[model samples]
Target chain A: MKASYTRLAAVLLMALASVALAADNDNHQVTVTVNDINELAVTGGDITLIISSATAGQNPNQATDNTCGLEWTVNTTNKKITVATNQSSFAHTLKVQAASVSGGTAAAEVTISDTAQDLVTGVATTLGTCTLNYRATATAAQGTQSVAHTITFTITAAS
Target chain B: MKRILPTLAATAAIFLSSLGQAADVAILNGDVSLTITTAAAGQQPPAVTDETGQLEWTTLVTDAVKKIIAQTNLAGPSYTLSVRAVNISAGDGTGAGAVVLSTTPADLVVDIPSGIQPLDPGTCTLRYAASATVTGGAGTDNHSVTFTITDQ
Candidate 1:
């Protein structure tokens, strides 16, 4: 009984000491806001939130630099669009617009590079747009989540 | 340094996954080169009174066709290929009667013949036994037929 009393007294003393030495929690504040806003090409979400085809003044159709999908980039790497299903990021893009075979010989690619990656491997940024229209029968698809060609042109060149 | 937080993160850790992809199906939406041919080979041509209804079908096989070349892509469940004969410029009683064409190893869904199998894709041949009744024309004179085989 004497030994038990001694242990209890020691624990009590330690608890008091810890409370006394505790740092001020008033400065230890936390705030969380949804700022890493990333947009997805949803079906009926934002009308502008789509894989749109550039009109007469879109980016280069036959690009000299490397890119996929209309050469879009993310503002923050913190947030990412999780393709929950069997949605292929590069495979799911709207790229049938690249089927246009005129002006110059053409090629196409859909790539996922490291710079624009959020999930390391899922659907990252455009690694490289398909750049070889050997068969030129192109359609931008995400597994099966895709629409029809959003662009058209007359053919003069062969690729 | 601050710890990251997202209340509406839907799920945990906010990781992303997808149907890890590689686009393989190629949809070449260009003008497909459509070619038509016939299987009636060896040139065992039929003879008639007026003119030889060869490619330049002069005296057509009245009740039958000599041969035809169907130009089409519809494989099966489409229209069956057919070619009939009638003298565009006909005499009083002489005219192209009826013509018939078929694919060898005949099936309704005539698959375009790939040369791997020796069967011809299509054939146009005249059934001499089935004749177009012709009594008297300007003469035992000649004529021609242009058989356009089609799946339309």
Candidate 2:
């Protein structure tokens, strides 16, 4: 009986020792992480647009350079233009009439276009006289977010 | 002795059963972190060509249809502006030349009467081909543009 008791004690001791030598595995979980970021910012200095008034018809007698008309251009031709908003979401405009314009508005049309699409107005671009339309919608680059959006504004007799 | 033997056997059985009880176990824990930084920039022309500039069409008028071609600046946070290029000369009547744009041609729906071709066609009418080489992740660089074109 004493021998049997000794063997049982030995067995219990061996089992207890086995449990103590295990791994300290009390910590392992998946965590979220952030990677790289590229910031694309825009400012007035980054863009260049020149729209002018040129008097064309009434100045028939004047030199061609002195003609009253709309002289405009986009300087940042290297970049692409997006609506940054949606069509009819928000609009920017300027009013030029026979009175404000050197020449009469007998033949005036609103011209709107970019690198891809062209928008035309058959009649003068008066608020009630004609409809001012533009496509406005914008999004930032993939994995990016856009803030402080901007839209375009203009008034010209180009169309 | 037999009763004692059975009692010892019960204890041995209990201990053996307890020893056989092992758990296939896994432990999991983790740490998370987040960071945020921002760098922004803008570029544009202070003012456009408000003053009259010379565009001598003598070089473009090879025929009556070849009048002039030019682009407007692609301004951002865009502003509204009018652009006109007009020059006259006594030339052949069988031909009618005009100014047009690659993006928004002035003569697309051109009117000989008003002479102002509406800005219609594309969003970015003017373009300046450019190229750049970026060195560091955080550094400042600068560039300027001067564009001239003549097309008949």
Candidate 3:
């Protein structure tokens, strides 16, 4: 009877051990890869700026348009937006300024030329927007000539 | 002596039965991968999701209910990652909704009925979603997600 009792106790201990080991767990890996994203878009349709009239004895009135805006989404750091024109020389001057900026500092009004000029500065990882204020100025000595300029905007690493 | 022999046989049978009914859990699917590479201008990055992973579990504990919990190894990630159980098999377990993944264990599936004979396993599909904002920048987060079956 004593041997039987001892065997029963051992069996009960083994059963308890199995119960303790019952809880199970498993694992799997999850890899998330995020790529650098920089997206820029131009809102509104094509705009036409015309300098048609001026006050007496003054240069032709400047034609200004704020109907268009620039929007960008950047996920990296130390970036800025630059603007350039395809025309190297023209009779009239075209200037652009970034106003009502949301995510970056607006540079001074830039005279559009072949060389790229900074339009927005201190743009880092953020979503930003600004109104593209365009102004066209002509003098009486330069005469009246319609100049169609193709402007390009680029986002690049800040200097 | 005859009564002692019968008692030992009954005890041995009971122990063997308990040993055969141990709870177990396993992942049926392999590692999951997700990516976030696009977003609209002037907006945050869109969330991405993957639903190819699955989980299978078994339990026979009659006294207590069982649940499946999930946890990750990454802490202080720049982006947000969330998970949920979906397309659950017709069993005793119910799918839990989306839960943001973190180091602390959170319930992914709950109300698992126990005492299942023949060790019928409950299974469910796993869905993982990852998202980021423009300010969060870009990076990768590798997480070793663990799933455990424990008494509730």
Please tell me which predicted candidate would have the highest lDDT against the true structure: 3
DockQ of each: 0.00, 0.05, 0.47
In order of appearance, the predictions have TM-scores of 0.13, 0.21, 0.85
Which 10 successive residues of model 3 chain A have the least lDDT summed? Answer: A14-23
Assess each prediction's global lDDT (C-alpha) against the native. Answer: 0.22, 0.26, 0.86
- Better by DockQ, candidate 3 or 1: 3
Error of 2 at B72 (Å): 59
State in Å the error of residue B136, model 1.
Answer: 44
Interface RMSD of 2: 22.0
Candidate 3 lDDT tens digits, B1-152: 86877577677768675665656778876999999999998888889999998887777756378888999999988888899999887876887788899999999999888865435678788889999888788888899999988888
- Which numbered prediction scores highest in TM-score against the true structure? 3
Q: For residues B1-152, write the lDDT of model 2, one tens digit per residue.
A: 74676576667656664543321111112221211122222112222222222222111112123223333323221122233433332231112232222224333112112111222111112211211111111221121111122122
Give each model's clash number.
Answer: 33, 59, 0
RMSD (Å) per prediction: 42.5, 33.8, 4.5
Model 1, C-alpha of B75: deviation from truth (Å): 14
Residues B1-152 of candidate 1 have per-residue lDDT tens digits of: 01222222212212211111111111112111111111111111112221112111111122122222322222221112232323322221222343232223111112122221112112222221111111110111111112232121
Clashes of 3: 0
**Candidate number with greatest DockQ:** 3
Candidate 3, B-chain TM: 0.82
Question: Model 1: runs farther than 4 Å from truth?
Answer: A1-159, B1-79, B92-152
